[model samples]
Target: MKYLGIDFGIKRVGLAVSDETGKMVFPLKTIHRSTRENLFLELLNIVEQKGIEAIVLGLPLRPDGEKSLTCRQAENFMHSLGRRTSLPIYTVNEAYTSLEAEEILSGKGIRGKKQKESLDQAAAMIILESFLECIPYERGLK
Candidate 1:
């Protein structure tokens, strides 16, 4: 089943998608949040257009695994998204995904504004990859 991975932020949201086999993932794009309603509408459109079967959303937890304000925000986003779509939604703890993303960008020599623009997308990829590792493709089929 194809899956959509999301790294939610207050200002910008990152998206990634898995192939039909769910073995490979790729960064899709980042959506700039203008309004909550518009963000949901755009996400819904992507869900339909991509034929996404499930959603994996990054839950931003503190390094110590405590829920922060951002974590609560992510939870709210998850609930709101669940209400909008019938697909199953899953959450992965996104503790250092952003830092990891930054490292990746730095290695690729993507710096400054350009790196900032792509940081979320890379984070989304990491979040999706983490989920994929936890549940292998064959296991996910059942």
Candidate 2:
């Protein structure tokens, strides 16, 4: 089952998609927040065009595993999003995905504005990669 991974923010949401085999993930794009309808419409287009089977979201929890304001906001977004689709929604802990993503970009010599543009999508890919590594294959989670 192919999956769409999301790193959702108020101003921007990062997107990633698993290959058809669900074994590899790649960064898709970042969507600037306009309205909820527009956001969902874009996602729906991706879902239809890409044959997405599920969605995995990043929950921006604190390093200590406590729920921060951002975490709460993510939680709310998840619940609100649940109403828009029947496909399962799963969340992974996204404590330092952004930092890791930045490091990845630096290692690859991607800098300045390019790094800023790709950061969120890279984070979504990291989140998806982590989830793919952790879950059992028989469950079709990856």
What candidate 2 gets wrong by more than 4 Å, as runs, is 137-142
lDDT of 1: 0.94
Q: For candidate 1, lDDT tens digit of each residue in 27-139? A: 99999999999999999999999999999999988878899999999999999999999999999999889999999999999999999999999999999999988885546
lDDT digits (tens) for residues 1-142 of candidate 2: 8999999888999999999877899999999999988998999899889999999999988878899898898888888878988889999999889899999999999999999999999999999988888777657844
What are the TM-scores, per candidate, against the unseen true structure? 0.94, 0.93
**lDDT of every model, 2 decimals:** 0.94, 0.91
Per-residue lDDT of 27 in model 1? 90
| Candidate 1 runs further than 4 Å off | 137-142
Residue 14 CA displacement from its true place in model 2, Å: 0.5
